[model samples]
Target: MNIKKIMHVENLTHFYGNQIGCKGINFDLYKGEILGIVGESGSGKSTLLKCLSGEISPSAGKINISLDQGGVKDFLSLPEQEKRQLMRSMWGIVHQNPRDGLNLRISAGGNIAERLLNVSEKNYSFLRNTGKYWMEKTEMDSDRIDEFPLSFSGGMQQRLQISKILSSNPQIVFMDEPTGGLDVSVQAKILDTIKSIVRDINVTMIIVTHDLAVVRFLTDKLLVMKDGIVVETGLTDRVLDDPQHSYTQLLTSSILQV
Candidate 1:
């Protein structure tokens, strides 16, 4: 059984003037698959995620996405308007900071409704109901649908952000440190909710994090990066259990010591 390939990235490189952001990155993301990019700070994992999610343009490389409309298109080649349309309809991004992804002044349900609106959902009743449904689905209380995001706890805000993104039923979701800065217990619950939602929705996801435990618990495949390069790429268990690269070995060993 050949799994459908949802994205193909080749020789992806980015530069910040004289500095390298990420270099020669390559990977294929398949439908319903979860891939993690892990590295320490300044490893360029975040830069790579930004490039992949269209937050920034790569200095060079090809990112081809299999479109639902029935063909592959170079994501980097699309017009700005088209890129925005694709992002609005088919791709979702969850930022490390929930505030970055959400509108703090809006009601939780309104935040979700805004995404639905972008996808051309016009019925007010359906939008409200969908928001309520997604809130519950993400383990958030539906009763707080009318509350502003600022009133929610950090964990709840993150869950609300997830609800807003997933409410549109996007084909791909890019998460940058989804559990970052939260309490360990909060992170655990969010991770569990994320895992369950991904499985339930069968949506493809690419996550960037420094936590090996996050990859171990949530990712099917992993990429270990150092100095803007992918030093190792393999199944999560294989890479963690028996890392071949020195950097990867160091990463795995550090996790073991903790």
Candidate 2:
């Protein structure tokens, strides 16, 4: 079966003045596929992600997205309002820090409701029910819907953030180190939850992280980056088991030694 392509990225490059952020990045993301970008600090994985997710503009590149309204469009060429609408409706971003993705001042359900509201959901009962449903889906406590995010533990806060993003039923999700800064057990649980949720929703995802284990567990395809370039790209298992590039080989070996 041929999977439909959801995004096409070509020669994506970004710079911080004279410094390279990411250069000549290219990839195709398919519907419901989870693609992982892995590298050490300053390898340009995060920079590439920010550029793709519209958090930052690229210095040069083309990002074409297959829209739900039945057409392909250059994401970078869209007006700011159109980009914001796309972000609000079809795209969801999960930040490395849960606090960065969530509103700490609002109740947990209110956070979910806010996203639904952006999508033009106006029924109060439906919004509350949907929020509770998503909380349970993310393994969060539905009863805590009224509680502030600050009152939750780090892991719970992350779960709540996931619930809020997924509640709107977005087509694509950009995850920046979603499991970062968590304990081993918490990481494992969050990863499992994310895997299950993605499967259930059939949402496409691009995740940037340093952990090889994360890519192994959650991603179907992988990109290995170094010095602002993609050094290798392939099926996750094949790349991990038999890395070709010197940087990729060293990266896989280092993880084995850990």
Index of the highest-lDDT prediction: 1
Model 1 Cα lDDT, one tens digit per residue, 1-258: 888898999999999999999999999999999999999999999999999988899999999999888699999988899889877768999999999999988999999999999978899999999999999999998999999999999999999999999999999999999999999999999999999988898999999999998999999999999999999999999999989999999888886553
lDDT of each: 0.94, 0.93
Which regions of candidate 1 deviate over 4 angstroms? Answer: 256-258
Candidate 1: C-alpha lDDT: 0.94
lDDT of 2 by residue, 1-258 (tens): 988898999999999999999999999999989999999999999999989988899999999999879699999988999889878868989998999989888999999999999989999999999999999999988999999999999999999988888888898999999999999999999999999988888999999999988999999999999999999999999999999999999999886553
Quote model 2's TM-score: 0.98
